[model samples]
Target chain A: MEEHTGKKNYEVDWNEYLPGVAIDCVIFGYHEKVLKTLILEYKETDFFALPGGFVLKDENLDEAASRVLFERTRLQEISLNQFYTFGSLSRFNPEPMRIVMQKNGLEPTKSHFLLQRFMSTGYYALVDFKEAEPIADFLSDSCQWYDIHDLPSLLWDHEQIIQKALESLRENIDHRAVGLNLLDDEFTMRELRNLYETILGKELNRSGFHRKMVNSGRLNRIGKKNTGKAHRSPYLYRFNT
Target chain B: MEEHTGKKNYEVDWNEYLPGVAIDCVIFGYHEKVLKTLILEYKETDFFALPGGFVLKDENLDEAASRVLFERTRLQEISLNQFYTFGSLSRFNPEPMRIVMQKNGLEPTKSHFLLQRFMSTGYYALVDFKEAEPIADFLSDSCQWYDIHDLPSLLWDHEQIIQKALESLRENIDHRAVGLNLLDDEFTMRELRNLYETILGKELNRSGFHRKMVNSGRLNRIGKKNTGKAHRSPYLYRFNT
Candidate 1:
């Protein structure tokens, strides 16, 4: 199979792809106190989707997800958590997928593996928004970050996948120390609280949240934020390595 | 394909099974302060494994897992959570699987779909130990429960599957009210702590644990447990319904 770009053509051997397993990644990034996810738009179409790829027969599923993440974000060794596996027969809608294949200059019916029902494992990673440079693959028009609340209509079960990933993220926020990955190395308590509020989609009590954070032993007081106003400056903290 | 037993032979059509996706259930039960998992032993062999089954083309994977759980336990509507999917290329050990097939009167090479690699989704359900009647399917000689700490050698990455399930269980124990399913309707504080300790495989600070549990707002103090001694009586609690 060849990915037809305007200027270049990239070849992918269909036979080398695994028959029934695929990986879709929900890459969560925090920007401007809002939680966002990286998504790809199909060229010349309104379709948006999670960055996904088929596993190679020789690779593990986690490795396949890592490869997809690295290709899209140009980052490596980012911890990816496998949250759920979506195996419903209706996960793949034939109409939109066919349109996508046709637009990419491929015949969907001939791609038997792609046409058949397959299971997709959802993996999520929290990344610093500014650190990731989203690059679209040849099959997509562009890769962009969308705020979780204002997402476009996604194709297939990508919206549900994002929801599940978000649920997993919220369920694990307090226990997993994910702020280390989503926030800067040093940040004010307000930034951390905002990150949690954004992901959890709720307003947490300020004093109680601060007390819980301080008692968790996962953070260390590093310095004070140098706000222009002296009386309003807050202590900055970092995740204890 | 046929299941050969001492009394009768059962036939199954290989074509009816889903091609590449399967479900394995790690059914966990608690008894005598020890956490145990239900496993099956194949007839005329030492191979033990988690109770598992293949999905049907018309059924969802979760439905397939539920069916497998119901068949093994003679119970239905047991809530099972999908924990992880195992898709490593080496997950299926060919030698052992071939022996299992041959012993079951299946020509492995002739069963192309069975011989080819497949992916399995792992699910776990917590059940009351005494409430479950372990029944072996035609493929196995007997079904039994084994203590998680003293597990027998399992077949084909099942040990890893159980380990992953245990990890997931431990991670969710504090957050989700899973004790509602694992414990009796009413219990003492010590019993609740014991259940938590058994699932977590560690001892927790008694007063701190109790305080956290009480503050979580998921429990209700129904009454006091009269242990036949004045000093030994403890508060009986139930999960807030």
Candidate 2:
């Protein structure tokens, strides 16, 4: 069992944080044409969860989210977006929290702040994975990347958080300038297509992809001219460089 | 002063609402080819604000938002989108709230929940102006629709919330099936264009708009075949049926 624990292991200053609220971040990175999400393994427990923390009473919610994101990923530069908030009564199970506390050599108090019902604001960001130095939160043993498609069982509704974050990312992929964080400036057309495929979970026809990208005017073309009719598939994909 | 006041209004059981969190809705409507937003003018005060309410300890956050929306607009079935959560330190001022409480016959308790800091989730929805019978919240004198472009000075950061909501709605105008809420099924092309133009805050070329609408495959031709080339305005608008 890992001896590591946040300040809460001793005593939590309840007034330091806003009650009934927390923040969770779904940190995503793209590399080698595969999309990966950063997750944490809880200390001395089989439980895994998205990196999250509480909002300080004096801090803006967005600032609190950014602090949590920066603390784990160590990437200050980002365009973090708040996608959704989750607050279901079922998410308030105290059993897992008890296990976490006991395993970490801390006694569980019925009135413990961590054991209380909390609604979490879900924030997400796209970052250059290579630049991020992953550091585990005090409650977690380790932080690492897992393919979005393959992940261990997660705690609470974290799986749903990841799905929602991914959905939001895909929805705004065209306007979010995601490539600035995920790709090199001198990347080729094939590399860009692979990035789209990874995010979209489907293969796009090569000719059609080229036509759409060129027509979008977000990408500057060098060398030879390219042209083609997009395939008949009804899905229209747009990109922002 | 109007005599109407909300239930806690008189006695806000802090237990009823999850403290420090609330929900605000920027209800939108399109009629007479003009876009308007629902706003409330507080009773016994010159204060105006969006329709909002606190969440119960047992209720889902979205459910609370929907309840508030229903209480104000009385629209039960809708596609309400949570656009953003506002929680800046500047929004914590208790002066306006004190005025509201005093004017509403509420004793200004130092620890009053309404005087404390609150983070509000902003929600937005489109509706037929005729269908939504505007009812003022307990604290307000009248619930009325004001053209978004020409609105009275608003309270708190609600102006920002409305701007953000309208922006989000416009961003998704093409993708969201907004026609269902704002327009009749058998609407004419000119009417549909007017609706889009109203939300977009700009005029669209008639022939170009028709060609693009038809090409997007969201609309079916009524009788004689209509044809035209979309002007090269560089905007690629899509629509959902």
Candidate 3:
């Protein structure tokens, strides 16, 4: 889309000799004890994929991931990070990609220049689904969140990509504060507990969970909500930091 | 090293593509509370690097890392897992690389065919110093462990590679047993404490540390270490798993 200057930059020429690498994003969101991952359905094949876009030549890996998350998901200025880079040479199989590319009247062998040697870095964003709307871009038909356990088969190494992202999320729980990314501005403590239980795949003891949750010092109790079915009013707490 | 002619055969033209990507090992060893990393000094320049060799075409990323670790550092059959992949388009700079190639009487412009690509995944192994013997390879003039805290400037993005490996190590400490990777078959409880202190960059409370450690049931007390100057013999323990 842009032109190179009159003088050829050897660096540019060097890049032309190499295959391009890109980044993909797997955004996870939680609501009401259900863990879901944001995915896009491509127009023709109805094939589902994590909402992803290519990395720009000038962007850093981390920035590229954020850019894609914002552009495709309509969720801007959210925190995202690089978790892994999938680089198995077999990832570029034309047989699987041929179905999708050929539908657009493109030759898999000639038009897919970046496929053979390309590597993709996977990044993940933990965001609230209530704040996100799927923006169908060039290749997508619709965007939606699928339950982690009930995901449709994905293209390329996407299944493995989601698996790795979940693993990274589980491992990072102690150091990273994920609740803020997935929760609403104000929510009941039970809502927060349900979110953790779903992501961790286990039930937490109410008393013990409350103790640890308070000790983390990130919660601010605002008010209580009287759900008519409950004996006591459930307190609402917002993430302070 | 082996051809793929099995039931799940994937047919592709090998010659049209660049050579398969490889992994490099940077094994770190600790002794006397000082961290050390294995390095191989190359010819024609004062620059040095971690003792690393090529990954075989047919091997998995982890296997390739272990192979390089064993073949070059003489740390045989040790496990080394992939931590990060470094593959920026400009990662393989041809400018200074050309000089190095020329110094070795090779035409850099022609010889370095994979100048812009050649993505290399970096893996790290943590081993006890007593088990390793660094050997000189084709490009290596010497092999030895340099103190990690006082490392000389490294080639490429090797510094960032080391940082990522260490961060991964820290994240895995709670769920995975990393102490076993750096300890001998048997060790004293004090020695284990020292190792944690060095890695965590903090001094732990003796009673608190002992309580948490013993409760974990991962250590088996063998006997006692007879310190001649000490009033009481210190207990010695071995990792149970």
Candidate 4:
């Protein structure tokens, strides 16, 4: 707890940040066929939020989002797509955030940057769940993945952020090869379908889905996976790199 | 010129605006089979910019964007999709904006809100070219459409904003029914294909494009369009309701 508080003491050049702009990332991962998001719990309060950071003065919005993602997940070169900019007036409901800051021994009046209205741009990235190592920021107690269907009480408008991110993901599933980011280098066709079903929140017809997927030309028929299950093993495939 | 300057005198509560957040819209229209974007020429300078406005404290970002669009185009109930948020430090680039303001008799020192850094969220809209009526704002001399390929020198990062909007539009054309917004309610398949090619910046094989369009199941055959040209007329179609 002391270490976390001390980490916040490092002076940030406030001028380098745009007063009213921030970046919130919705990092979606597929684990055990369940869609999850990376979240952080504040050290002194029970408030949870999407892993986010303010845009640096010299950085582009996308670059800022990538920096936040890398800082949290320790993964580089992962692509992030901008989906929506959340700028509702009530988005920065400061009561909970103020409480968290007070509990962390920082006065709300002194932290001008935190109290100002923030219009956050939402950037989402799909990453392999097994490869991501979630690390909490200095102000947070723990960083972990939560099932999107059963999320904890989130701070600010993070719940809405997650919902919008999910909507964007579902709408873009076919248009973009997003599943490739969530799956392994090689996976069974069944695994791929399950991943889609999880994100889409609906079951897809097997034969129709298979035919459509094959015709999409985004996948390559790789070698078969030898699973020790009962019947004949399903063929494995990977994204056309 | 007097009327334009008088319009800017309407008292707006600067404190009621979010300190540094703004919205810029790229209103895209297709005319004469050439893609064009709505632009405004500042009254005091030859510089042009996307029709943009600051975010009111009580308004959502989308609402602000919609207001800007409606104020400029005089159209309501049109949907605007957000593509990206431009937050680069140099995005404001005050020199040109300052020049325009001074030329309009606005003292930059007195206009606190205008001089501050703004992180603007970019929203784009596809509109039927014939239906839209572009109007210049208080500080602009004219509001008109310019062919995207032959755009004039624009203010700040507006050129970059338009480029990003075009990129987003091209990528989402197949995924979303963007053509529906840019075309008349009922149009021929050839008109649809031409619209696609204009945005995509390339020609497509006629037969293959027709096959793909038909397979997409987004269009409904309405009737034959009597073009009155010497050749055979083509079938008219409308988007599926």
Clash pairs for candidate 1:
none
lDDT of 1 by residue, A126-160 (tens): 98889999989877899999999999999889999
Encode model 4's per-residue lDDT on A1-241: one tens digit a residue: 1222233433544566767788899999898779999999998787899999887656777888888898899888999988888888778687877887777676788556777778888989998888899998877888899999989999889999999999999878975558778878788878888988999999999989899999999889976677786368788898886
Roughly what TM-score does model 4 have, to 2 decimal places? 0.84
Cα deviation of A109 in candidate 4 (Å)? 2.7
**What are the per-model C-alpha RMSD values against the true structure?**
3.4, 6.9, 6.3, 3.9
Model 1 misplaced regions, further than 4 Å: A1-10, A175-177, A225-233, B1-10, B174-177, B205-211, B224-235
Clashes of each: 0, 0, 0, 0
lDDT per residue (tens digit) for residues A173-215 in model 3 = 6444587777777788788788778888899899898889889
lDDT of each: 0.83, 0.81, 0.68, 0.83
**Candidate 2 local lDDT, B1-241, one digit each (tens):** 1122245455556677788898999999988788999999989888989988888878888888888888888888777888888888888888988998788888889988888789889889888889999998667899999999999999999999999998898888876457777887556678788999998889999999888877878865444322343342223333344
TM-score of chain B of each: 0.92, 0.88, 0.83, 0.92
TM-scores of the candidates are 0.90, 0.88, 0.83, 0.84
Docking class of 3: acceptable
TM-score of chain A of each: 0.93, 0.87, 0.84, 0.92
State which docking tier applies to candidate 4.
Answer: medium
DockQ of 3: 0.25
Off by over 4 Å in 4: A1-6, A9-16, A174-180, A205-240, B1-16, B90-92, B110-112, B174-180, B204-235
